[model samples]
Target: MSIKYKFHDPGAIYFVSFAVVGWIDVFTRSVYSDILLESLTYCRKEKGLNLHAWVIMSNHVHLIVSSREGYLLSDIMRDLKKYSSFRIVKEIRESTIESRKEWMLYLFAKAGQQNSNNKNFQFWRQDNHPIELDPHLNMFEERIDYLHNNPVKAGWVTNASDYLYSSAIDYEGGKGLIEIDLLV
Candidate 1:
């Protein structure tokens, strides 16, 4: 995995994306999305993640993140993916109000079967697609814009800051759901 998604610079900010298996709309429900948010909060508080920007879409999440306090970015990514996958899959399985439970489980199960790494269900895809953001090239700002505008482009909201599941609100000078380290 390190060969594919290399985090060479320990202190450099990276724009990373990880998607659900089959691009399933798993986050249409607030429960699953909230689980992810909670896990992110845990990671930030306990795992030394320096989160600069983030957006959670229906099928994937975009993050501009780094590591601090001697933490490796790759290790943080691994733990985040592992924990979130387990919690989200468990929530989906146990949710009584989830109308598409059976179908969703089938899809996840099929994805797991295709991947030898997963035991039963594969919630998140293996690739994080981490792109190291170079401040000299202004790639950080560009990716932040793209990340915030994802909800707007998907027609979920007319304005990026109007979306609740993103750090756009933080960028706009309002407190967002998840506390983030502001990008200066």
Candidate 2:
């Protein structure tokens, strides 16, 4: 666990990507995706997270985010990941409609077994791979476009704004599922 990609500059906006333990399609169901959305909402309202862009794919999520003044970006990310991982895994286990419950649990459990930090299951991977966004270099705009277009690139939707689980709608001047501070 190197500190190479860890959030160091609290004021710097970062583009981060975090995936499920085995790249499982855990977010195929709205139940799981909704949980993630709720977590993001909580992070924004209660955790001082300044979200500029975001997209929730089937097995992972991408975000361009920063912390408000007096808050640490790393702390916000740690809490968001920790809380969402626990809640999402719990939801999967308790979901009566989840057809792949056993399989998903097995995979998560196996991943947890390999990772010493987890008690029983590991939902998200340990690393966020945060890349600091440089607005002067136009990396900010580039990353935001990439984040919004993720679902479109994956063939989930023809237009990025049509993707319901992304902030593309916000960028398009439409209300999105979660409240976001638009970058573009």
Candidate 3:
């Protein structure tokens, strides 16, 4: 879908997702995932992204986050996608393990054409569908639980808190391995 709405507001809760080109399993490696983690770190520490919840799936990412420091969520997403897009393409080209690189790139090109007037590659979907969250306690808790349980529901892990890549542990009042800004 075309990005019709440019969400530049800081205090908005966004539940965003970006699929891999052709829904390819590009996040099968630790390196790409590390890049995502690094982006989140940069968001929290530098860009003022206050993450309430997030889950890294095989082909997509789900994040419920907002920024309080007047930084736009769209800008944060643009930087992350641009950086990860280049790295992922480079890795696919160089790594012998990436057998599906050609097919994936082809599909990305197709999607980009369908989605926009992009010429080369499109790593993530352009639209980041952000829903404004109510400050009520129950609604906040419910969404947080959903984010944490996503990996467990997908059968990737036995327990929600066991998934180190997610914010489940942090929501459960434990120390998360990836440094996250405490939900604001």
TM-score of each candidate?
0.95, 0.96, 0.85
Model 3 agreement with the true structure over 1-184: per-residue lDDT tens digits: 4664356456767666677766778787777788778878877787777777887888888777777666777777777777778777777777787677678878877776776546677877765566666667465667777777888999989999899678888867898768665564
Residue range 1-184, candidate 2, lDDT tens digits? 3223488788899999999988999888888899888989999999999989999999999999998999888888888888998999999888898889999999999988888777799888886679998889999889988998899899999999999999998887899998998776
In candidate 2, the residue pairs with backbone N, CA or C atoms under 3 Å apart (3 or more residues apart, or in different chains) clash, namely none
Best by lDDT: 1
Ranking by lDDT: 1, 2, 3
Backbone clash count for every predicted candidate, in the order shown: 0, 0, 0
lDDT (0 to 1) per candidate: 0.90, 0.88, 0.74
Model 2 scores what on Cα lDDT? 0.88
Off by over 4 Å in 1: 1-4
Task: Return the lDDT, model 1, position 130.
Answer: 87
Q: Any idea what lDDT model 3 has? A: 0.74
Which of the predicted structures, 1 or 2, would earn the higher lDDT when compared with the native? 1
RMSD of each candidate? 1.5, 1.4, 2.3
